[model samples]
Target: MTDLALLQALGALCVEAGRAILDVYDAEAIVVRSKDDRSPVTDADERAEEILHAVLAKLFPGVTVIAEEAASRDGAPTEAPETFLLVDPLDGTREFINRNGEFTVNVGLISRRAPVLGCVHAPALGATWIGAAGRGAFKAEAAIRDVPAPAAYRPIAVRQRPAAGLCAVASRSHADAETEAFLEKLGVVERRSAGSSLKFCLVAEAAADVYPRFGPTMEWDTAAGHAVLAAAGGAVTRPDMTPFDYGKAEAGFRNGGFVAWGARD
Candidate 1:
């Protein structure tokens, strides 16, 4: 999967997973379950993961998967796998519960501890962002096939920070006190709210300059957007400014606070 062609193919697999999610979403409410972490899961998550697993099993038969919906303390292999896909079918069930149109379908492909390809689809919002290392990153918003069109793809980069004012996105429902303190410290002139991975997409598009996640979020929650943000000329860094890496030996599949931006590296 190191080759450019292989990366692109993996991206297409991500898109297919998105479509599977939309199918589940378009149907009526399905069963919702609680994981050990007590996070919510709908039929959408399982169906999408199943679809992705089936496709990748054929495309990259030996590639292991570490999807959020499929993981638990019960059955994780004893050894860490080298390459895998981290999938999040419904990123904001809370938003989906409120019918706020903020959830997304995300898929990330990682090799050697870094995201090489990723795709995120917001069926309700009709937006899709896709990225691959070196080949560049792109987003699409169109109705045709409800899918992204390659011809319309444009390379994205983070906008330079404004000297006088900066805009940032806080979680619409989870804008905690620390997020407020951080935004206030950043001296943002205005603030917007979005749900799910849309927060990261906002920064990637330069619609907003930054998103600081001081709250809890798993690896699946950020991995795809991390790739997109990085591809869009932005980065995700810890409070110490060290870039978050995937495929850690001890961390399993978790994430920590980081910022996303649209600016020069």
Candidate 2:
């Protein structure tokens, strides 16, 4: 499939994944477990990841994947192949457990160490952001999926506001005093709370702008959304405002503090 088509196709996978997550999410007596880092995990995360990997492998045969649930369960992929899939099946386990409905399914395509195409779907919230390099970002409401095989496709762009009142995107569960102190310096309008990498989607779509994440995030966390926001005319810069550098050998699939904004420099 063409890269643009690949993005939309993956978008369909995201929708399916979202439905599975919601199915488990709505079930009675859901159980939550703690990983070694004390972060929460749930059956939904595992089941969604399993389905996603199966679908992705079929779609792109021979493409490896760095899936969170699989890595968490079977241990990290022994080798990081040059080209592979990056999946975060369930982005907001805390929000899922809290039943706040901000969780998401993130699927990213990283080509030659750069985010090329991606999709983020929040089923319960009925929102999705899909993008591809050289093709601008778009949002689709889940409710419109049945109308003539889908109809609500609107182009999305970053807010071109001057740096006066920035909308600060933040984590729903990982909020810390340090990040709060950092927000104070940005002339934030207010905290826009979202679970998982959906914070990046908010900035990508200009629905909200400027997400400064100081906490730990792996490469998979940002790559997909990074592509979306970058394609939408946004910037993903280091804390000091340098453009972000991914696929560095030393970083080993890890990411550092970076600001994602819809408008670029």
Candidate 3:
């Protein structure tokens, strides 16, 4: 598919799944379950992932799609081609359960183990961000009833480092001592807390200067936002300062500690 076509489809899929998530979010009671890994899974997660899987199957026939809830049930494929789809229908279940409106639906296309296109939709926030390789990243008002086209989106990019110091973003739920230590080392002027991929989005749009994660994150957790950051002239790299790679079933798709930086440190 052409870049624009793929982005539109991904944006629509993410928006649709976000609507499904909101359906459960607004309900009286939301059922939650624990997978083997003991992570909480809610009705919204499964329902939205199902919506995404179905649409992705139709959009890209025969592509290997790795979705969080589905992989937990059916097992992730040990091997896949260079190109595939990764979906995290509900990226911040904790925030969603807490009714914080910080959760997001993430859909990413990976090529050569790097995210090429991605869409992060925050249903409760009524906003979505999308990024495509060579085309740049954009943000749009996420309409629950319809997916806005790229024409309705605003292009975004990272900013140069501030003269004072770096503004850092960290996980609101998973912040830890190690992460704090890392942030301190960055000469941060101020620290911000956020849930899900919004941390990466903040850096991508230059709202924050850096995001350092010491806690565990799955590929689906970071892929969409990583793509956006990268497209916006930012980077997500390991503590060792190497590029992050995906399709790691050996590690159960879990990601190591990493730092996301805007244009400058």
Candidate 4:
């Protein structure tokens, strides 16, 4: 399949997974559990993951898929292949538990240690963001199980850094002093707190100028949003401004501190 076609497939998959998540989210009771790592999980997470895994296995047979719930249950691989997928079935379980409209379903493709394609779908918000290496980036109002038409998707790009000072988006659940200090150093004139990968989409769509993440994150947590931001003319790098690549099987796919910038000077 072409890159654009692949991107569209991923987006559609996310939307399908998002539908499963919303079904659980709208239930009368949402049962929350804790992973071995102590992070929250719910029925929404598992159901969405099941949908993604089954669809991915059929859609792209033989490609390795490292998903969050499965990795937490079964140990992660010590190394990754040249090409693979990272999935966060239900990002921001806390937001879902809180009945907030900030959770998302994320799927990202990593090739040669770089995020080449991704899709993030926020079912509660009825929005989806997609990006690929050569296809640019776009946002659409995706409904449950119904992928938006090509014309329905609007191309999006990062905005040039504003001279007035940067507008920064930070993690709402995992705030830290390090992130605050970094934003302070950046002279952030405006601040927004968001849950899940939406912070990256904020920068990707020019709603914010940057996102600095000092708290711990996994590859699945950031990869899809990273692809979107990168395709929208942005960058994600270490706090020291080094290159940020994926397939860190040595680190159990855990992410280090990184900053995502829109258009930079």
Candidate 5:
């Protein structure tokens, strides 16, 4: 399928996953459990992932599917494929458990080791962002059951660096001293906290200027948002300024320190 069509399909799937997540989010209490890694998991995370996996398997029969929950259960894919779909069905499980609205459902299509199209849905916030390479990016208010319509989304792009200084965003749950030092060294004028991949979307849409992540993150944690940021004329790079590539099986699918930039810097 074409990249734009793939993004649209993925966006729909994200909305569906988001709806399932909201059902759990709006209920009385979210039952939480720990995975083998000791990270929290909930019914919402597993259910959303199940839904995504079903639809993806049906939609693209041959494409390799790598998902967070599945990886935790089954282990990382031993070999990287040239193209694959990565799903973090419910990112920010901690934020979701805390009843914060910062979590998201992330769907990313990786081609040739790069994210070519992506959709990020913040179900609780009623917003979704979609982007494809060379197609730019957009954000729109979408309900749980609603499918994405073109007119509902407004085109978005990263903004030029403000004369004042850079506005930075960091993981609400993962922020550490090293991240603070990185921001400080970057000469940040303002620092904000957000959960999940929304921090990347902030820079993607120019809501923030940069997001420096010094802690651990899996490829699924960042690919969808990375695609959106890249399409919006932003960049995600390693500390040495190299491009960030996906499907890193040797690294156990974990990412090293990276900085997402809205400005050219």
Candidate 6:
């Protein structure tokens, strides 16, 4: 399929997955469990993953999918193919548990060790971001069961760095001293805290100028948002200023520290 078509399909699937999440989110009691890795998991995560897996199977046929819940259950592959899909059915589980409306459904397509297309949907916030390498990025206000037409989405891009000062975004749930020190070194004048992959979206939309993540993150955690930010004319790199790419199956798909910038510095 074309990149644009794949992005649209992923967006729709993420929206559907978001609906499943909301169903569990609205329940009187949300049951949570600990994964083998000691991370939190919920019915919302599994249910949404089920939906994404089923739809993706029918849509893509033979493509490999490395989803968070599944990987947590069945150990991750030691090596990945040149192309695959990375999925985090429900990102920011803490935020979801807190009912902060900051969690998201993420689907990203990785090709040649890079995110070529992605879609992120925050159901509670009624927002979605979709992007592809050559097709650019877009944002839409799509509520439950509301799939906005392609034209309804407004194109989005990162802005030039402000001459006055830089604005930075940090994870609300997983802040670390390294990230703080990095931001301080960058001389960021303003800082915003957010949950899930919204930090990448913030920079992608020019709401913030940078997001430095020093804590551990999985490929699924950042791939979708990374795609969006890159498509919006931004970049994600290692703290040392090296390129950031995916398909790190050797390390159980774990990610090292990285910095996301609205514009190249």
Please report, as a residue range, the 10-residue window in candidate 5 with the lowest summed lDDT.
142-151
Candidate 6 residue spans exceeding 4 A from truth: none
Residue pairs with colliding backbones in model 6 are none
Against the unseen true structure, what C-alpha lDDT does each candidate score?
0.74, 0.78, 0.88, 0.91, 0.90, 0.91
Compose the digit string of candidate 3's lDDT tens values, residues 1-265: 8786787778888888988999999998878889998999998999899899888898878888899998899888877678988899999999999899999999888899999889999998888888988999988885564688667789899999999988998999997889878877777889889999999999988899899987788899998999999989998889999888888878888899898989954
For 178-265, candidate 1 gives per-residue lDDT tens digits of 8888888878898889999988888888899888888777777888888888877788787667877877546666676777766733
- TM-score of candidate 1 versus the correct structure, residues matched by position: 0.88
lDDT (tens digit, per residue) of candidate 6 on 150-194: 776899999999999999999999888888888888899999999
Q: Write the per-residue lDDT of candidate 5 for residues 131-214, one digit (tens) a residue.
A: 989998888886656876867888899999999999999889987889888888878999889999999999988899999998
> Which of 1 and 2 is ahead in TM-score?
2
Q: Runs in model 4 with CA error above 4 Å?
A: 143-145
Over the stretch 104-199, how does candidate 2's per-residue lDDT look in tens digits? 888877778778778888878787888888988887785622211235557888888656677788888788887888889877876788888888
> TM-scores across all candidates?
0.88, 0.90, 0.96, 0.97, 0.96, 0.97
TM-score of 5: 0.96
Q: Which is the better candidate, 2 or 4, if ranked by lDDT?
A: 4
Worst 10 residues of 6 by lDDT: 142-151
Better of 1 and 6 by TM-score: 6
**For model 3, what is the alpha-carbon lDDT of residue 92?**
93
Q: Name the lDDT value of residue 195 in candidate 6.
A: 98
Q: Candidate 4, after superposition: displacement of residue 113 in Å?
A: 0.8
RMSD of 5: 1.4
lDDT for model 5 = 0.90
Which of the two candidates, 1 or 4, achieves a greater TM-score against the reference?
4
